[model samples]
Target: MCDTKHCTKNNNNSRNNNKNNVKFIIREATKQDCPSLKQLIIGLAKYESRSLETLPNIEQLEEYGFADQLAKRLFRTVVAQLDGGDGDNNELIGYALYYRNYTPSQGKGMYMEDLYVDSEYRGCGVGRALVAQVAKQCVDAECTSMEWLCYGWNTSSLDFYKNLGAVDIQESLECHKFGISGDDKLAQLANKTVDQQSIKYKIRTGVRDDCPAVREMILKFTVDVKMNLNKVVTLDQLRDDGFGDDKDSRQYRLLVVQLDDSSELIGFAIYYNDYSLNDGKGLWLDTLYVKPQYRRSGVGRLLMSRVASEAIADRCHTVCWGCYAWNRRAIDFYEQFGAINYSLVYDLRLFAIDGPALKQLADCALQ
Candidate 1:
């Protein structure tokens, strides 16, 4: 609930500084902000030309974001409130919602689920201040990166984020986003029966002992995707993080595909539950990889099917993942299940900051 006040030039700076001055304070959102937050969510949805029908109601929002139960609170939010010196005039102008995520290579990370600034206050640095607050939290939490998605067509926002030291991963990493949403579609996909060829394989939940195989496969997956295996997690850390005594504190869930005859691991999918203002409860598929030899044997789809099945059981609204645009095989496989190519339809691109850039951005926040 700490407040950070910022002053920025308003449209009417020519007037006496004391009269038309525009200042705002950024602070963590509280349960009481849910009503205002819900309205802002609607404004954002309309502005983005997205539907609001599927969004959670205000009560659900309170439960999902500010409930007493840690497991029920899915994300954290920071808001920008107008500060007119007169406390009575304070008005919420914008907010940024985010949640924690983990990357095998980067460890702890943060993903911004939603960011919106009222159209009237667009250029007053509110958005920047809100993001800075989130970035500061990233450093405080020892996270290695902060990531979000932006529509490629929104050049203005692209430049805004670029100025904040973020890089569009679509351009930098050459990856595109995709998602499967709607209960009907998710249910249909969850019911899919993987057509395993004559070669037999079994998909099962990974355990503590599977860390060694999982780590090896993670390296292979990184190389296969032509990405550097920089700062990858160690075997012990992976095992402890995923299979720790506190099950509720696990970072990610695992599903592995094993050869039935040899009991050898051939593929794995790493995913975790996620929540967003737009999608409500959802699942993020962090990494899904199949050994080269097992590529066409339906192991990949089996893993995905299992992921989708679990998501549906939990009543998740969406299941999302990213893959390189050049990976037509992967793209085609996902399309078979009615997954929408958000990158293609909405021109969305993933953006991220990590390593030195992230450190620099974090340092930019006021001490």
Candidate 2:
């Protein structure tokens, strides 16, 4: 939900009214709203040229909308309804579905999963209102930032988002895949040399009490690039989730590196296998951090080697993560490990609400 005070700004403006003097109300969605939400998602899929991949089927919607534990824990959907805007009937005109996202490097963030307005209501400020509502929610949640992707061809939507003060950090978003049949040979070759000699320090599976040290390492790595290290999981949170009786608790695997004799933690790595996609399996290397003094001493390489080997063992087909574009040191390290750049991300920011003016700025390269 949005913070009422922050959302009040410009929300009551007459610009959002329809031709019939109809107003709109933004409120949390109910289970009864699932059908309409599905329709809106389908519409959005068409708009994005991904109609074939439309998500949240009716059954899945019911699960996530009202029943799924994680969904209930993580997200909330708000719908925009017309007060007599829909031919004197107060019907749904649009919706915004968003959830929290956390990365040790990026910190607490919000992802706007879906935001769409009925085509008939396009020019009446519906989109802007939805954005403002999410922004308010983001502020209320105290998130370090908010992010979402807009297609390169969607100039109007891109312009709209930029007008609302979005920063496109796309160039820093790197992705890599591993564990595919052919890739396993490369991974095996990389691992054959992994021995006590290849390891500059001892590596062990993380214990429950290691969260604090792990978090500190992550904070240091992210701080090197001016990124936030938010409170995603504190030591208490880790104990609760990892030690708790939850089926999904086994999803994560964390490893820590330490000096062989001193037993001092100097680095850490976190990875997990995700089964959400149908393409075999997917593995994510969420974080890999080593103390600056220990860096370039094979600590990072040892961590990467272990992660890739684990991905192969798990039968995963992809192992991926992002690196900041300006962090040339990190990029060079990743290249040495055989990771290829799959996409480019562009970060753009808007200082004002003028759509045309923002578009012009986006057209110009950074000086």
Candidate 3:
């Protein structure tokens, strides 16, 4: 039951502890609750020894959370109110915030971003109720797991989470938090003051003719990630999957970067159109790779810029991609473009439905 405090590993359980017959009403938050939520957030900051001035303002929260059009909400929240509970309180006393995340491990996940129960209402099941609701949402979303963070010194909060079965991944994995290091958006990148050598690279759409070169780079890319090349894909298969004229069969697009002088391919990006009913249209960066010799030469940035430009052209709401945990250089590169890294968030679990598993599952379904 958590979102982002640093996206560390999380403990998760699916249980509802409302057996105490609490009188509070917990429901999804709306515009009317913004003020209450804001006040709660400020109180939370002060409790954590921080100040309200450091957080987003009401107008910003409204725009980002409740705006009808062009809303940039990063999380969905639910608030706890009263029906016949303590003092017959109808005021918002507690809230929980969560958001969806994805990583190479956990294909998709939900992170509970914030949860707070009013001081007056503490120990009255309000906090547990909010968390139970968020956990329910985790199941509704079919997320791999739920994750969040807590202050190391907050023993009470830590105990509450431990009771919920959350594991501290930070103890084992080096936790690193990165914010969007660049102030520029996709459209602004091309015009930004950049390396002089960037002008000499050509970013262009890839076609069937480039599949061979693309495949060779794919081999090197796999090896660079320390992943074994289990099987090599032939150029014909690559074309059929990406460049085929049969629009129905083609599922991905490719972009290749080359030196304008020598026309040598140095980097590549493969992507596809992906949509979520909740998020509308988004572009998935499947693979991004640069030749070993091209490292630190700005080729990687050039390829990413073109990929982003294409995403903007398609009106994609966001671009999604993942990098290896050990690939600090690539992570830093992406931060320059405002990519939120969720690698450490939640327990990453990828399910590969292999041939035997597919057969076994199919066998379970009766005709």
Per-residue lDDT of 1-367 in model 3, one digit per residue for the tens? Answer: 2322212121321112354333566778998788888898877877877655556666756755667753245457888786543465578888887665432222344556578888977776667667767766665554445666666667788777665555554443434332221224556654434483654777799988888888888888777766546544556667766766776445468899878888688888887655422233556676888888777777787777777778778766556665655778878787777667643442232212222322332222111
Candidate 2 C-alpha lDDT tens digits along 2-89: 2222222233432334343436666678878888887877777777656345255666666545565652332467787875543667
Give the lDDT of residue 78 in candidate 2. Answer: 77
Rank order by TM-score, top first?
A: 1, 2, 3
* Model 2 backbone overlap count: 6
On TM-score, the leading prediction is 1
| Per-residue alpha-carbon lDDT of candidate 1 for residues 41-139, written as tens digits (9 for 90 to 100) | 998889888888966798988988999977667899998887666568778889999998987865778999899999988866667777877888998
- TM-score computed on alpha carbons, candidate 2: 0.63
The better candidate by TM-score, 1 or 2, is 1
**Cα deviation of 43, candidate 2, in Å:** 1.1
How many collisions between residues are there in candidate 3?
A: 10
Instruction: State which candidate has the highest lDDT.
Output: 1
In candidate 1 the C-alpha lDDT for residue 26 amounts to 73
